[model samples]
Target: MTDELRSAALESKAWPYEEARKLLKRYPDGKPGGAPVLFETGYGPSGLPHIGTFNEVLRTTMVRNAFHTLSDLPTRLIAFSDDMDGLRKVPDNVPNGDMLREHLGKPLTRIPDPFGKFDSFAAHNNAMLRDFLDRYGFDYEFASSTDYYASGRFDDAIRGVLRHWQGVMDVMLPTLRAERRATYSPVLPVSPKSGVVLQVPVEVVDAEAGTIAFQDEGERIVQSALGGLSKLQWKVDWAMRWVALGVDYEMAGKDLIDSVTQSSKIARVLGGRPPEGFNYEMFLDDKGEKISKSKGNGLSIEQWLTYGPEESLAFYIYREPKKAKQLHMGVIPRAVDDYWQFRGNYAGQAVKEKLGNPVHHVHDGKLPDGTLPVTFGLLLNLVGVMGEGATREQVWAYLANYVADATPAAYPELDRLIGHALAYHRDHIAPTLKRRAPAGVEVAALERLDAELAALPEEASAEDIQNIVYEIGKSRFGEEGGFAELRDWFKALYETLLGSSQGPRMGSFIRLYGVANTRALIAEALAAA
Candidate 1:
């Protein structure tokens, strides 16, 4: 390692962004000769791509970006669609047996995108990422395992891996016994809860060509990988592929850490060097749950793109790759708000770096941009609260478009903050339910809130609305504690009426949603009561 790299590793505490940047700079002019530093990622095609999958891409993309821009390295991001892997089970909410029949034994890459615009299964899976990358201004080379297996790219590596297959098994079996309580080849899935294990058998059809067949524990034949003239076992396949592809770094969730560890050992035994980087990231549901496909609790990447801005989503995934955590859907508003705040911080930094000034960009100096330093889910809700005319679709569209634009240069920061604030309102605020009151009682509360809003002057800003609500709150509840009462009352009233206690602040919500429209809603609530 160079002096600069050693310094960065120590000072930055081995952060992926810093480490990746240092890798490029370690070499003169950031060139690894003919060997291109590869930022690699892969995902199974068993279900709709989840938000966590996006994280895998984002973490690596950040590394790739740092190498090219920060370290001035010529690097490439290689996308691997594990479409040749067998399907584990049919995901929930999908059309059942029929869908599985079409996809059974096929690699996820071969599965058709539910949207049907893509040509192959891998294409379908890759397209979700393609859309995300395009939306986020990233460019990558997409490769499919099936294609690589067929193209003879790993011929030399495959032979080496096979020669050391026994050693690979020795390393993997012990780890499996220690961590998972079973020893099986690369494709086996261990039941996390029951500790039960199922061994997947891979049939070696052509040892010379690298073609194989896969079968379940029940001996049911699943998929076949016909070697164009070469094949390796699952463990060997992994190690050889990494070397063959020249992967410099790959990030995965905690679950895959074991597999990668095993693969690393195999890489060493086979006389091929393991990739230089590895990062284990956490998976989070919208509400901080461990996102899982089997439990049917994970949020799809599509859903993420639907509700949140691309930048916030990216930041959420990349913020801390080493920790394992659940992301709850309920708390996404807060997350969005935090991301926006961070964007504002970035804006401040950019200004300081370019124009050399410090100003109230937003959220003071607590959050910054480009570094994924803050959360803005709340701000997204606020934006939703303020934009009465916006729909969830429209809001996401605005965010998607905003992040895509290259102009105004600093627009992403503003866009993220606004997007988070708006999203928070739509997802959390507008859907509130009266927590402590009956429908009839809540209608009365709505009437009271409406009365306060009705008194506000025209052409008001958010602060004006806040002041009006605060005054009404003071009048109704008492001078010292009135604001809380008013705020609580509005929360209940909106929940009863709009189904969310979290709506935009009453005054601003009414104004943006339009006084006439809000009044109409309140009147309806009263009538229903």
Candidate 2:
């Protein structure tokens, strides 16, 4: 990849970490043209996919995209689902116990899809990315553990695993020191007649129906069939799976960093024929408790999409997958717009400065103006003013209007800019409003409010009303309040009209929306009062 391309990746939140760059240059064609590079990633099917899921795919996609942009020496990206990993516990809204018991101890590929539309659990999880990637334009192959194992890829690897079982344990010894993390157990195949693995202190027993079992020191029993494997534990299985499949690069959250490292050691012992490279991405929402399917506290990618463009969600995940980032509700719409705008500017600068992705020359789309972007908040406010409903075109119009006046001369494509702004607005602003109304006032009670204010010793003139509110807000919110109160008020009005409390500001909002329109809404409130 070109320097500009490398920098473009960095700007979009892809790290040019040492290992990644080395793989970029070498694995595809660096030394006597290495094996066709294979990039892999996966997701757990336990919950709705979140922005973090995008991070995993987007990062891998960037690498895959970069390679595709290059000479195209046969690079492929593969994604999978760990459906067979174990349901462990029920996810919210999903069935529990025996409902999922049918999938217990099997690879996700074997479990039936909970939704029933897909053939198996692996298919369901695979479908999420297939939909997402198709929308985002990433190139990748979809893989499933059940399919791989069933296809006979694991047979030879299983034999190799049996050959190097002890060395695998030695490599993982250092990681098992901590109790919370001491979960790995290496897999070793059985000798046909002896029915026992060579090294580990495991017992072999034969039960009914040609079934075989292996018991570890902890008394954990692993069972298999006469001709197949049901006994390889998860950790060792994770490592050998990669080696068997010839994965060259993969990125995962920090939570799995230790486990993957231990697995790498097993790969080394098994013949050192492992995926040549790996990247340790940071976990998002790391500060907050994990968003297990059990907790139901975390946001999902679909939830993020409801607010804005998929691109912004992609940019956000791209920008901060490895970092501990938070996705508060209503943030993606704005972020999507912003990332596109930033990406546009970054690309422009890179072309001018000769620094980021060269493909940016051909890649269109950029970020929008800040604050003025056509956010969901602003759109809701416009809809609130309309008293009927707003269409996508109307939202786009407001965005264009806002961008035309607010953007500097340096930006010439105001309409396009507005599109970006609206994109961000949709991504970041919540469709639902968060209104914190004044202690006693309500839009419906405005008549009583007016009478109450009018009956006071002196009524506030328009100037006084503006000054009073502005001054009070300024005192509390500082310089930002000069306009923020208007924004908050819109939020309040949105909440009042539509049960959402966030939107455009007062003055500019009214100015752009028109006073006649404002008076109409105010009159309705007064009449109700």
For every candidate in turn, the CA RMSD to the true structure comes to: 8.7, 8.5
lDDT to native, each model: 0.55, 0.53
- Displacement of residue 160 (Cα, Å) in model 2 is 1.4
lDDT of 2 by residue, 1-529 (tens): 5666545544342342333565655554442345567788887766556556666777676656544544446667888766545445555644444555655544455566777777766576668767876766766677765566556667677656656656766776665566523444454434343333323443234333323344444455555532435435666877887877777777766777677777777777777545544554443343456545445565666665555556566666555344566665545546654654555455346442422322232132223333324434444456545433444456444444334444334343433443444443344433433333332333423333334334433322334444433443344332432324544443445554344544444444544454445555556555544
Task: Give the poorly placed runs of model 1, Cα more than 4 Å off.
Answer: 1-16, 21-34, 96-120, 127-132, 176-231, 286-289, 293-296, 324-336, 350-465, 471-499, 510-529
Model 2 C-alpha RMSD vs. true structure (Å) is 8.5
Candidate 1 lDDT over residue span 397-478, tens digit each = 3333223442224454544445445554556555553323335334444566678667756666656766765654456564
TM per prediction: 0.66, 0.68
- The clash count of every prediction, one per candidate, is 66, 36
Considering every candidate listed, which one attains the maximal lDDT? 1
